[model samples]
Target chain A: MNDRKTTQDWMKDWQALQRQYWTAWADATRGASGEAPDPATPWHEGLEQWARLFGDASKQSETAERLLATAKNYVALMQSMLAAATGKAAGDAAAPAWTEALRNGLNLPGLDAALHDNPLARMLRELRGPGAQAIDQLSASFAPFLARAREEGLAWLGAPALGYTREHQEHYQKMAAALLDYQDAVNRYNALVLKASRRSFEIFEDKLAERDEPGRRIETLRALYDLWVDAAEEAYAEVALSAEFRKVYGNVVNAQMRVRSQIQQEVERIGVDLGMPTRSELNSVHQRLHELRRTLRRRDDDALVELRRELERLRTEVEALRRRPAQAKPAAARSAARKAVKTGNARK
Target chain B: MGPIHIDPQRAVAELTTFNQKLAAGLKTLRSLDEVDYGATPREAIYREDKLVLYRFRGETSPTAKTPLLIVYALVNRPYMVDLQHDRSLVRNLLARGEDVYLIDWGYPDLSDRYLTLDDYINGYIRRCVEAVAKRCNVEKINLLGICQGGAFSLCYASIHPQTIRNLITMVTPVDFHTPDNMLSHWTRGMDVDLFVDTLGNVPADLMNWCYLTLKPVRLFQQKYVGLVDILDNKEEVENFLRMEKWIFDSPDQAGEAFRQFIKDFYQANKLVNGGLRIGESEVNLRNITMPVLNIFAEQDHLVPPSASRPLQQHIGTQDYTELAFKGGHIGIYVSGRAQREVPAAIHDWLAAR
Candidate 1:
């Protein structure tokens, strides 16, 4: 009996120790890593006291052993749970109904509880809680009603099963009919109004015509004569100004020919007076100009052919004037001219 | 005991023939080089004016069911696919009788500074897709998006699933938090606001410099050193020049688009979380139900394996294949090794489907 009492006492202590170990392990594993526990008052003293109470070397070692054993068992239990849930266990023995009961209690209808017990499914359930069940219930309750309502609503709305509604068609048709009626009414009203207005305007117009008929006739004749005169004057001016008109008139014919001849002679005379060169002369001049340019570019020659030509023309004009003997002065200037010639010869 | 003398006439004849063939081949290559490299064409895919899509009429008759619309990233020219005769991905696809349409994102300018995600995803991309559909006289088109374009394409496909026939994404990043990805680590501490503010549109040169800096020792020193060794051979020289031209050809990313990409996709990880918004529509990955073929380079440094692996898991499509090519990021396009593997895989997959 004493031995039995000792065994019972040891078993009680072992159980208590196991519970404490598991509690600590659970707290350590679940809690944040690298976190300091709450500071005790007089830190070192509190630690000493803690060491004396729970952190005793011998007792701590025993606790660690118990904790490891508890963890092993916990892992084994988890493995067994996973295996059973996945239906990997031997024999046709059904899995424990606790999983189903849990699922049912959570109101997860149509869910496979066995599948839900796995880590991945648990995570999914946490994320979307038995949404399928809720959806299924909603669908089951409302599907038929929704279908019936949709059919009846479609019919009530007057929509074609495959296309748009007759209301749409009728609305457009009514609009078109109304527009056509309005157009017809407007046309009829406009025609009648226009006829009445036209008759009224005709009467007014007749009165106006009666009031101004004589003046109008006189004005018309005056206007006609004025238009004829104006047209005749314009025609006469046009004919007089035209070359054909000049030819027909024959007036100033010799004077115009003489003027033309004089203008041509003046142009030729001016060309000769200016010593305007011929084509070949111009070509030679251009060639001389080019040679001059090339000489200038080379910075060699100073003489320019253009200057020589101008000097030669001037000398020829002077000599010609001299040769003409100044055309002999008039009688009043004969004495002066003779004096000038004597002075010129004396200067020469 | 016999000294062989040179066959001078035969040698000369052979040399002449080789030269003629070489000249002919070069002429053909030059004709094929229609796309202007290095300089961005004044007219690009997303220019403000009318969007003109280039259609390469291949030798084989086109199967007029649905033309494939290839959406390439704005970071580089789309002509990388049509680089040269031997190294051209677009040419290979065309050779296989595939009617391919590419979105040549014209280089964005200052006026495009205000261009945002909505503009690209809803405006430009949607318009391009619609245009392709109209041109092909089909209701839908196959979409193949590369790199950043893949991400944008994914968003577009999610929003407009009805307009897509098949989806192909190459070197696309879906999960931003993948371990061992250098880009992810580098981006984590990046001051994106500072970058966007300082540069407006992130300059292509700066991006290229940073990318090259990732392997600075090899890129700056060894690449040119290797080139010097191959300069004697004419074919090798031409090949080197072509690759160099393709490499330096870069395009500036629009500022607002870059900002949104960094903030939403990179920093916030919004795509994987189903929080990405393309215009007013939510971009849910589960909406991608079309046949998907995801190709990733196993030896890629820029886009690590982890960066692209999650696509297979996240997408809702059952007819999905993950093709792993043992190459770097660029090898998928220009490497001789990929000339057989990548294009063949895509061709076979597309043909089978």
Candidate 2:
């Protein structure tokens, strides 16, 4: 009977605490120009409301968007921890229950199911800089071809073809093979990432257990979140710095390049069919231009070197000629030559 | 007892304050204008193709007889040194009455796909050094190389030591096969020919993506999470935005140059093991007999200190000096401590010689 009463009292306190959170969120967003907050919605909705209201299309929009994304995840974490806090006594039942809560918090609603628990994958997906194509986006574009390739075996890939379209058929087979290789590499990379993610959780649990000591306990949502980040980064670095990861990373990059090369070839073919200029044609022109420039530069350099030699030779000759006047003509000879010149002038 | 000890009411209060800060910070972020870099005044002294050599103008006449030519890496823009007024390395160096000149390696397009490392180091850098020396009426000029530029400088100095007075290298990677060098490890297995053949020029975005992946959780997520604390401050937001602009602003590397760099420097470990060539000239670090000052950041992840500390072992300079910085690669240029220490250190070291 006493236990039941205690449960009822805690439940009441939890309800009251939730009401206070909503009230605080409403007040936070009240000044901003957005719709009223729904009490039933997640706490991050308040942030979304503020973002929607103040996030103008400006230069800072990208930064704002990134901040909003991370902030939403952080707010979700806060909400999860608060819920966990009310469900149990403070500093009690923190390991398993809070760990589960933290996991649920990160796997927030409305995220793609693939990225539900894999924050590393999500980070990879969103980590691309401006003007850089996301690898995930590229993979999505090639999904249909990859899927079709998987369904069909490679037995026919090596078969000889004797028809007008034989070359095209062979090219398609090569593209499919490259796609399969790329998929394999991506799978290996993802497996490592998954391992890292699992290890991160184990590390997080251990870290939390360490914090059980007096004065070392995590007392706030931000502190707990930071601890989780530390654990996540530590686990990620261990995996990323491993020799196996280096091989996998290289394989993924090389495979992707091959796949891209094949796609570019196919696109060039299509472009040629449409009577448009192709990458191959442009590359040929660029290569020729580059060669011409190199030749011109080399010639220019050679010419410059020859000119310097000529200039030095002329300088040496001039120095020698100036010395000849001093050496070949003595002072007495100069006087006699002057007198002879004067006499010749008189005769003229 | 368990770990977390969050009081529900206190957590709600914290969240409320966080939301308020976010709201105010967004307003500040919106009100700010586009950030501009390169704080000091500069004049273009020479131009060839897309590359330009600029001589920075200081408040007074430079006291140094020999001009210090900064050979910046081609992977990123050179303006990182002169990013802003307070954080500008160029500005600080100029303030110390040092004549500063920099080589601006302009963005490479598809047409520049065939530009080889020989073209960059021998053709562009050599000419720029000559141009700076000619303009200053000096036979030899001081060389200060930053990051990849430092490697290029080492090669240039090795091949043509007579043209250099004093060589200063900042955060340069000498031994590429160091155990802690992640970038080198990842590139060891890559087929450079295939990479360059497919991508005419390495796009800056791809390079940035690779860099961010080095520490994804911290760089992509936690960094922004920490930004929420400073969002409400306009000054802080501007600082953040300036850094953001510089972080993403990068140049597409010339394909052939990138290929050779990755193959020779990262894969072959030639800078340390010898057998490096720029154009027709062989690069032997032993030929770098000039007074050398090697400055490396201790915490630099891009170019680990382990990779940089091997310089003293490889070079044949009897007057070699090493200065260990207490920061990372970028921080060594832009941090407050850098502003206080780096320019002064370079100036003092150069002044002594």
Best by TM-score: 2
DockQ of candidate 1, scored on C-alphas against the true complex (2 decimals): 0.00
What's the DockQ for every one of the candidates? 0.00, 0.58
Output the number of the DockQ-best candidate.
Answer: 2
The lDDT per prediction is 0.54, 0.86
Give the best candidate by lDDT.
Answer: 2
Off by over 4 Å in 1: A1-348, B1-52
Candidate 2: give the clashing pairs: none
**Candidate 2 stretches greater than 4 Å from native:** A1-5, A31-36, A54-56, A94-97, A128-145, A313-328, A331-348
